[model samples]
Target: MVLIRRMLAFLMLASLSASVPAFAHKDHDRKQHAAEAMHNSAHQEGAPAASRMHQEPMHGAMEMEHSADEPPLTFTDRLLSWIGRLHPIIVHFPLAFFPAALFTATIGRRRASFATPVQFLVVAGGALAPLSALLGWLDAIGMDPDPLLTVHRWLGTMIGALGAALAVWAWRKPDQDRSGLMMAALTVLTAAIVVQGWFGGALVHGVDHMNW
Candidate 1:
């Protein structure tokens, strides 16, 4: 009876010892799984912040590239800009002379005395037209392209061409007012100048400048 009791006690002790190792292994596995979960969660939480940190420098680099694209203005560019500014001042000469030529040319048709003044006005206006157009082109440098700009540019070009043609005609002819062709050309040029003035006013003021 004593031997049986000792055997039973030894079996119980072995079973208990085996169960302790399994319980310890389960606890270790649970701890390992929890540690892995914490690491994964931390990484996920930091990912967006790390991504933003990386993007900030990239954005700054893009801005630097954009800024570096434009070179510094040279002396020639500055000189040209200065010359271009003269466009506004020089433009008034042609503006006054062309319309005055039209008036004189019309009146000169009746009186030979007015012919000299008509020829003078035409020559002065014609000579200044090309210079004004050139200066205006320079003034418009680097301006953004738009509908009004297109119309203004082409209109100025046409006026310059017409002015040159009229000047050459007057130079060859004895009396421009007597010639029907010269009178018609003068009328057309005057009309164009008037239209140009309106566009220029629109540019200075607003599209609604004519409303009043």
Candidate 2:
């Protein structure tokens, strides 16, 4: 049963992460519109010589701004961007692990043998959650900021903190959670994951992401 559960969880994670690209596709249109607007604004009604004079300095300033926006295409920038891209990939692990841990912890409350697996999942999930959050921060560097993005950022950070704390709590009180504190914490962790997922989806797919 445990093996089957683990296999199913892996499959779910794989499917979820694989669909991230599709969710992000809408952003491309928004980006294109913004680019077009910038281009159009750069050309304004005026005398030809006056417009050229105005554009020259503006063009130079825009170049400088673009350079500041993204680091030079050096090895370090490339490597960080590559790792940052892995945010989409790595995020699924904790998404799977914490929920699995919640399940195991709940079941393990009655069956003590299941505690070990819960601990394992919690520790693994807890560690990776922060790494995933860090990668997300790096990846968001050039992203357009919005309310959804702000909420996702803070919520993701909290999830990482809660996951890590849950791991430590489970470790420190390996056999004394009969009061169901760990179970409750795990439940809250799972809830946070769900809410964070929605915010993330909304950021990529817009406010109507869940509209049927």
Candidate 3:
């Protein structure tokens, strides 16, 4: 039963993970367009290669062919792409773990027994947050630049850095501080994640994805 549940969860995650070749395909199209434009100019100068390209009208027919197809991904390329796709899945861990840690820490104010869970959650989030951020950066490669992407990328970087620092702070000071500084810090981290999530959704859906 446990194995079945785990398998189902894996399947769900795999379904959510999109293939990376599409991103690379966009890069390829840009390069192809640039190359063809250069060749088009060269054809004006009677270059042999451009002479051959002029045999068919690009805007009328050749453009359709180039736009319709991209080079196929090899098994190894797919395998490597799977690594970057892990970002979407791995990010959930810190999102849950950080907030849960904050909650656990809040409750631990009344019951000391909650201390262990708080520390464990913080440590777990710290371990995964950097990996998630790294994968996110990898996934962003070859994607078109945008303001939303800029905000999401750097914000995620900050989250990963702060998460690690928060974990270290938790480990060093298991007991509450006089000012509750760690709790305050944890709150900031959680808030950042929420904001980053908004930008991420905008990137995935559209800028007005949440519009009424």
Steric overlap count per candidate: 0, 0, 0
| Least accurate 10 contiguous residues by lDDT in model 1 | 170-179
- Runs of candidate 3 with Cα error greater than 4 angstroms are 1-64, 67-80, 176-179
Worst 10 residues of 2 by lDDT: 40-49
Give candidate 2's error at residue 96 in angstroms: 0.9
Please, what are the lDDT tens digits per residue for candidate 3 over residues 66-88?
A: 86697877787676677889899
Q: What tens digits encode model 2's per-residue C-alpha lDDT throughout 1-212?
A: 99999999999999999888766876787898999887776675346668789899999999999889975687877788888889889999999999998887676678878878888888899999999999988878767878888889889999999888877776787774433787788788899999999988887789898999
TM-score of 1: 0.66
Candidate 2: regions farther than 4 A off: 1-72, 177-179
Candidates' TM-scores?
A: 0.66, 0.64, 0.64
Taken over the whole model, the C-alpha lDDT of each candidate is 0.86, 0.84, 0.84
Quick one: best TM-score, which candidate?
A: 1
Candidate 1 vs 3: which has more TM-score: 1
lDDT winner between 1 and 2, please give it: 1
lDDT of 3: 0.84
C-alpha root-mean-square deviation, each candidate:
33.3, 12.1, 16.0
